[model samples]
Structures are given as structure tokens and as C-alpha cells.
Target: MPAQLVWFRRDLRVRDHPALVAAAEAGEVLPAFVLDPALERAGDARTAAMLTALEALHRATDGALVVRRGKPEEVIPALVAEAGAEAVHVSGETTPFGRARDRRVERSLDVPLVATGTPYAVSPGRVRKGDGGPFRVFTPFSRAWLEHGWRAPAELPSQHRWVRRVEGEAIPDAPEVEANLAWSAEEPALERWHEFLDGPIDDYDASRDRPDLDGTSRMSIALKLGAVHPRTLLADLDRVAPKRSKAAQRSLKRYQTELAWREFYADVVFHHPRSAWHDFTDALARIPYDEPGASFVAWQEGRTGFPMVDAGMRQLRAEGWMHNRVRMLAASFLTKDLHVWWGHGAQHFLDRLADGDIASNNHGWQWTAGTGTDASPYFRVFNPVLQGQRFDPTGDYVRRWVPELRHLEGKRVHEPWKADDGYAHDYPERILDHAAERQEALDRYEAAKG
Candidate 1:
């Protein structure tokens, strides 16, 4: 049988992987994973998670993963020649770098290079407005995306014939660089998804914003690594027996919308690749960036002195993740309060978050900075103390992540420095006054507009 090369990029799984299955069908499979220097140097928790996921895939396939460290354009052609492969199969990527890299590889390869849909239920850029233009707003885009739906999950291949003749290097024992935050990889990812389907998804709408509640799906890392395909989640949602309970349906819808947001951002990046580096709103390009200093360090170290902000930062540092509501608040604090450039904040998040996809991270920062399509208004800055008190009413979330504020108790934890006694010795004072900094952000926005 002719060997067919399966080039694994972001999609790393045995199940629901169309390209892998296709490669297996075509010929004896030679699974290859390129440890590209570009991705390695990116050196974030997400990259570490990818390496971990690759390890899991290696085990699942009985050590079939072929590890190569080079650019795909150069490495793929070399692999095809060495393996005598008939063709290359890959799950198509939507990011600008990915698209460009794939094009280069295709041109260099002597054999055919087949591509398939992404792990997402619907591929990015597939949904469009009635006028045949790409959508700039999410609501209409999501509506059309749902209407367009996607194919049902494919069955896992029972057996993949491996080609022993193909000589390749072994998978690395770990990521090239150490991860800044801790993260559970493939197995934990699967367990978390099952747990979410079992209970929390039912109460998602009512409790998701409540940091004290066990509410979110917590499957973002899995989604990012393709440990579990979005179809699996969509299938679970469809199977849910929608009862008259307002909370249940609302929660389910909200969870589904969050998935939509993931795809929405991916679509945004695919359509406007330049937004990866430049502002989505061309006029906002002039927005000033604050110099990195003590305030920025405080935000990164989780010593910002605002209970909710610190809690969110601590959660990210400890678990390689943060609650969705907290992500917004923390991001807003960086862009609007500290006056840091959103790109700097985005880099920090990418360095820590296990779920950090370039599409989501870049667009999320843009949304927080009010520079993306349908972004939060520049003048609407979140008050961290109020946000903490409202979302984490009992302060349990704060106490769990920011133990220094635990003794304060109740709503007071949100503003420990505001107590007549002032802050505890360990906890730092507020790095910058929110009201004053918020006004400065507005002034910057106004100046940029002029």
C-alpha cells in the first residue's frame, strides 16, 4: 500500500479527526507532527498543552507520531519523499500564518495535499450575511451559522495500518520551553467535558457569572487542542432534554453562545488577517500604549490590590485558566485602568492560558480595547470592586485564589483597602485609581479619534 502522510497541526485526536481518517483510508498511515520553531518560540501554555496533547495522541496511536523540527514547507516535502507517501492530509487551519504556511507547503510538495474542515462544528468564513458579504456583527453571524449547522461526527477508525518503513524522530518528552502555568492535558480535558455534560451545563446561565459556583464547561483547553471536537459538545447539547426550567434552557443557550463566540472570533481573524497585528478599527491605531512598569508587573503577579482582579490573575497563574466573566474584567482593567496596550495584555494571556488560540486571544483583547467589530465601547470601563462584589457576592472565589484577602470577609473582600483599617501587610494597595485612569482612557480614545 502507498503511504499517506497525516500532518497534525492543531487538530490532535484519534476521534472525530477527518484528515486522520482520510489518510488512513487512502493508504498505510504515517502520522507526522512538525515542531515548527515559530510555534515553539511562541512558548505559551497553549503550546505546552499542544505538546501534551501530542503525547496523548502518540499513546493512542501506539507511537505513530513522527516528530520533526523544521518549517512545514521544507519538512513536509522531505517527509513525503522519505516515506514515499502518495499524499498529505491535514485539518485546514484558519489563522493567517497557518494559511500562508499551508500554501507554501502545497507548492513544494510533489504529491497531493488534502485538507478538511476544522475541529469547529462549522468552519470559519463559511457563514455570511444575506448580502453575500462577511458578517461584521456576531448576532446575525451566529444565526446564520446555526442555520448552516454542520455534518454529524464521523465514526472513529477501528484500525490504522502504520508504515514501519518510514523513519522519523521520536516525540519529545515535553515542550521545548517550560510553561509558566500548570495545566492538565488530554485526559483531564476529556474528564472535564464529561463532568460538564453531567451537571454544570444545566445551571450554566444562572451560575456561570457567579465565580463561587461550579458553572462553566471548562472544556476550552480540550477544544483548543482538539481533544474533544466541538461536534461532541453540540451533540451533547442537542441530546439535552429541554425542560420548562428557564434556568436550564437559558444556561444551555448561553453555553452554546459562548461556543459561537469562539467561532465568531475565528471568523473575524480569517476574514481580516491584518487584525492579528493592527487594530480592527483603522482609526483606533493611534491609541497610545502605556510603558511597561510597576503597574503592569502588579497585574501580572496578581498583586493589583483589587480583590476580583487579583483573584482572576491568581486563577490564571495557578490553573492556566480563568472564569469567563473574570477574563473580561481582568482584560478591561489592563486596557482601561492600567493604560497598557491590549497587545501586551494579549501576550500575557497567551503565555498563561491553556485555551489561548491566536484567533480568540487577539480578538478578545481587541474587544476589550474597543478596537474590534462589535467591541465594548471605549468609555465603558469595568469597576473591579463592583464587579467582584456582584459576581462573587460571597467572596468565596476571591478567598480561594487571593488568600491574603480571605480575612476581610463578605463584600468587603472586593475592596479590602477601603476598610477603615486599610490593606493587610501582604496585599498591595491599589496600583492605580480606577476613576482617574478610566478618564485617562477616554481621553486617549478621544485624542485618537481627533
Candidate 2:
């Protein structure tokens, strides 16, 4: 039997993985992961998480997982020849970089490169409208996505026939970034999913907005590494939700909508590849952006003096992840308040976030920057102070990360400048007045729309 090359990119797990299953069906399988220099150099936190996930995939294949370092175009074809592989299979590529690489790899190959599945439940570029055009907005796309529906989780292969002829290198150790990496890997990821599905998933809608509460599934890192597929989560939700209370069922549905948002961004990025790096909307492109200076540095270092934004940025540095609500707040501060381009903040996020995806991270920043599909209007700036008090009513989220303000108790914690004696001696004063900056952002938006 001709051996099939299984090119592992994002999907790095053994269970419910489509590409691996298809390769197994065709013939003996050679599992390999190519570490692209671009991706490998991303950052210590993301690199560490990916290396850990690769380790899990390695163990799943009994150390037969091939780890090559090079461009996939150069690395894959040589491996295919060395192993005498008749076919190559992969989870379909969606990002522009991934797409270009796949096209090159396909061109260089003699055998057919079969794409079996994608990281998303409904892969981008597939979901469309009645006009056969991609859905630009999310609500209709989400409704259409549910109508389009995804397949049930694929069955895990019962056995493996490893064709380990071509030797591959060792998966590297976690890099020295000095930041804590979130999520150990596959087994831990699955464990987290099962644990979330058991209880907190019911209260997701309630606490998902509140960063202080233990309310979210924390499945992003898992989804990023493909330890557990969205279909698996959707399927498990189906199995367990039927017996759940109505409120719990609603929460499950709410959580599922979040999943749809992920797919929606993927769809958006797939259709408008240029939009990944530029504004999706033309008018917003003309908006004047300020050069990032000390203010931007302060934002990066979590010394912005806005409790919610500061806490969120610091949380990102400390945990390599931030709450969803906090992300919006931080993005708004950078783009709307500081007038720095959204791409700067997005790149910073990509550099840091373990779960960062080009689709979601870029589009999310565009959404806040008022430049993407169904974007927040430039006028509708987020009030970090109000946001902190509302979402983190007790101001615990801020105090948790911005410990300098720990002395200031309760709601008072959200506004340290409001302290009767000014900001606690160590903590910096408010970097930029939100009210002044809000007007500036609105004025700039008006001028740019001209």
C-alpha cells in the first residue's frame, strides 16, 4: 500500500481529526508537522504552547510525528519522495499565508493533496448568501452557518499503521519568553472542555462578560491547537444540553453563537484577504492614525492608568490571554483614544496570544477600530471606567491585575485618579483623559469620512 503523508498544520490532535482519519483510510500514514520559520519566531508564549501541543501529537502517534523545520514547500515534497507517499492529506488552509504555502506545496507535489477538513466548524470561503456572495455581516452569516451546519465529530481511528521511514527532528523545548504560557496541551485541553461542559457552560452567558467570574470554558487555546474541534464541542453540547434546564440550554446556545462568531471572522478574512492587513471598509482607511509613542508604550506595559484597560493589558502579559470584554476595551483605547492604527495593536496581540488566529484577532481589532464588516461606529467609543464598573462591579478584575490599586477598595478601584489623594503613590496618573480623547476620535472619524 502507498503511504499517505498527513501534513499537520493547525489541527494537532488524535481524536475527531478529519485529515488524519482520511489518511488512515487511504493507506499507511506518515504524520508530519513542519515548523515554518515565520510561525516559530512568533513569540515564546505562542511557540511554547504550540511546541507543547506538538508533543501531545507526537505521543499520540507514538513518537512517529515528524517535525521538520523549513518552508512546507521545500520540506513536504522531499519527505513525500523519501517516504514514497502516493497522497498527501491536510486540514484545509484558510489564512493567506497558509493558502499560499498550500498552493506552492500542491504545485511541487506529484500526487494529489487532499484537504479533508479545517480548524473551523464551517470553513471560511464555503459559507455564502443567496446571491452566491460571501456574507459580509455576521448575523446573517451566523444564521446561514447554522443552516449550513457542520458534520458530526468524525470517529477516531481505532488503530494506527505508522510508516516511519523519513526521520524528522525533535520538537523544541518551550522558549524563554519570561511570560507564563496558558494551557499545557491536548489532554489538559480535553479535560478543560469536559469540565466546562459539565457545569460552568450553563452560566456562560451570565459570567462570560464578567472577567472576574470563573465563567468561560477557556477553550480558545484548545481550539487554537485543535486539541478539541468545535464540532466535538457542538456535538457534546447536543448530547448533554437536551437533559439540561432551559436557562442552561440558552447558555449553551449563547456559547455556540460565540463559536459562530469565530467562524464568521474566518469567513470575513477568507473573502477579503487584503482586509486582513487593511481596512475592510474604504472610508475608514482614510482615517488619520497617530504614531504610537510613550502612550502606546504605557498601554503595552499596563500603566495606562485606566483600571480596566491596564488590568486587561497586564493580564495579557501575565497569562498570555485576556477576557473577551477586556480585549474590546483595550483595543478601543489603542485605536480610538490613542489613534494608533489597529494593525499595531493586532500585531502586538498576535505576538503574545497563544490562541491568536489571523481571522479572529485581526478582524476583532478591525471591529473595534471601526474599519471592518459591521464595525462599531467610530463615535461609539468604549468608556473603560464605566465598562470596568459595570462588568467588574466590585472592581475585582482591575485589582486582581493592577495590584498597586489593591488599597483602593470596591467600586472606587475602577477610578484611581478619583482617589481623594490622587493615584496611589506608585501608580501613574491617567495617561490621557478619556473624555478629551473621545472627542478627538469622533472628530478624526468625521474628518476622515469627508
Candidate 3:
């Protein structure tokens, strides 16, 4: 029997994995996952999430996951040689670093290196506008994306025939880098998807912005890890659409648009690779940033003294995730309130968020900082307290995450400092005056434009 090597990267699952299935067709498959030193150096919640997914994959595969720690360009060739594999197969990656690394691996390998099914349904740079250039804005891009539909999800191989008895290294335990943040493997992700489909997706449009309710699909991590394919979710939406009431259809459409945003950002990163680290608009590079110090530390630690902001940060630290609306508010606080660089905020988020992907996190940070395509205007700063009162009105979300403010009743939890003097024992005072900081940010933006 011919030997085939299958490399696993961000796509960790066996079911509906095109590369794994293709490799199995050639011969007895040797499934391998490399713990690249570069990834470990990135050190954040993303790395921890990868480790958790790998552990789950091992369990699912009956301990068949091969573990090697090195650069893929060198390691893959070595593995291919040792296993006597005829060819190697892998899913394509879209990130700048990943693209470059895959190219190097392809050149180094002697046999054919097959790359398939990118991290998205429609691969980035595949869809374009009239002039044959990439779509600079999202609305037109989303329209073009829908017109260009994706392939149906592939089926998993039913049987595995092992030709050689090769013992690979053990799968590493979840990293200790972000010990405070709790992240589960694939099982919870599946449950979350079912729960969203069963309840919140029908009411998504109305309640998504209202952080108090479970209004959004929390399956981003699963999607990112490929434990669940996007097609599965898309099919579910279609199945339930006809049965839903008018309001539910409207809400479901809004929810689907967010998924499009994920693809939109992915396409943006693929087309404008430099935007991954730099401003998408060169003119906005002149924006000033505050020195990283006390305020930055306080923001990361969730002691910002602003109830909504603090709650978001606390939830991130405790759960390895935050509500989508709160994510926007928290990001706006960093870039607009503190005038910190978006790159700084991006790094911090990458360190904490379990679902953090370079395409989404980096672009989302740039959008909040007013430096990306379709960015929020620099003047439209989010008011953290008002946001909490308006969205999380009952203070359920705030109390759950920021326990210090638990004793404060009703909407008063949003501004605990406004309560009686004895309330000082419960919550800290306002960290930074929002009005004053807003003006400072405006002046800085204006000065940069001038």
C-alpha cells in the first residue's frame, strides 16, 4: 500500500476534512500535527485553543495524532522520508505568515504537495469586482460572495487501514500561558451551535446588540478550528428559515450577515496582506498613540473602573471569550478612550480571546481605530456606561462578570460610583473621565488629519 502524509494545522477535526479524506485515498494515512516554534512564541489564548483542539482530535482518532515540534519545511520532509509516504496533503492557509510558510514547505517536499479547501467556503481573492480588483467595501463584497457559492461539505472516510506501526510523540497538554482563561474543546462548541439554532438565532437581530440576552452564535472558535464547518451552520439556517416568523427571518438574515463579515475580513486580509500589521489606509498612519503604562495595564486587568468595560475585560479573562457587542465597546475603549495603538489592543486580544483569528481580530481592531475599510468614524466613540445601561439594562451581564458590582441594584450597577458613599466598598470609582478623554481623542484625530 502507498503511504500518504496528512498535515493538520488550524483545521483540527477529522469529520468533513477534505485533506484527510484525500490522503486516505492514496494509502494508509499518517496524520501529523507540528508544534511549530513560531506558534508557541505567539503565546496567547489562540495557542491554548489549538492545544485543546489537538487533544480532542487525539481522543477522537484513538490516539492517532502524530506530534512533531519544528519548522514544517524541515519536519514535513523528514516525516515523509521516515514514513515512506508517496505524497503529502494539507488544507491551505490564508494568513500572511501561513501563506509564506506553506510555500516554503511545498518547495522543500520532493513529492506532490496537494493544497485544498482554504479556511473559508469561498477562498479569499477568488471573488472580485467589475474591474477585476478586490472589493474594498463589505456590502458589495458580500453580494459578490453570495453569488459565488461554496462547495458542499465533504464526507469523512468511514474506515482507516493502518499499513505501518509507527509510534508518534504524545499530544501536548493545553498550554499554561493564559491559565486564568477557561476554554473547552469541540464538544461544547457543538452544544453552543445547537443552542443558537434552537433559540437565539431567530431573535438575533433584535437581541444581538442587547448584550443581556443570548442572541448570537458563539461557535466562532469551532469554525476557526474546523471542528464544525460553516456549511453545517449555513444549511441549518436555510432549513429553519421557511418555518420562522417574519421577525425571525429578519433576525436570521442579520445573523447570517455577521458570518459574511467573517469571510469579508478574511478576504480583506488575503488581498491586503500588509493590513494585517499596518493601517489599511496609509494616511491614518499618522494617528498618535499614548505610551503603554498604567492605563493599558488596568484595561487588560479589567479594573478600568468603567462598569461595562470592566465587565467585558473580566469576562474575557475568566471565560476566554466576551460578548460581541462588549468586544466592540472594549476595543473602542482601548483605541478611542485611552488613545492606545490598535496594534497594542490587537495583541492583548490575541492573548486572551479563544476565537481570535488574525483576519477577524486585526481588522476588527483596525475598524474600531478608524484605520480600515468601512471603519467606524473616529468621532463616534462608544460610551461604556451608557452602553451598559442601554444593552445590559438589568445588570445581569455586569454582575455576572464584575462581581464587585453585584450588590448594586438595577441600572445603578452601570455607574456604581453614583450610588451612596458606602458603595465605594463594592466597586471602584470611574477609571478615566470619559468626556475629557473623548475630546483628547478627537483633537488627536483632527491633528493627524491636519
TM-scores, each model vs. reference = 0.93, 0.97, 0.95
How big is the RMSD of model 2? 1.4
Best by TM-score: 2
Which runs of model 2 end up more than 4 angstroms from their true locations? 178-184
RMSD of each: 2.3, 1.4, 2.0
Writing each residue's lDDT as its tens digit, candidate 2 over 1-450 gives 789999998898988899989999888899999988878657667787888889989998888899999988889999999999999999998989889989999999988999999999998988889999999898999999999898988875676598888899988887766454445477888888888899989988799999988789888877887877889999898899889999999999999999999999988888888989888888676788999899999999999888899999998998888899999999999998999999999999988887888889999999998888889877889999899999999878888998788888888988777788546458888888899999999888889777
lDDT of 1 by residue, 206-316 (tens): 888987787877778778878878887787777774643666777778888889989998898889998886788865788888897988989999998888999999888
Worst 10 residues of 1 by lDDT: 175-184
lDDT of each: 0.82, 0.88, 0.82
lDDT of 2: 0.88
Clashing pairs in 1: 205-251
Off by over 4 Å in 1: 175-187, 242-246, 420-422
Q: Candidate 3 overall Cα lDDT vs. reference?
A: 0.82
TM-score of 2: 0.97
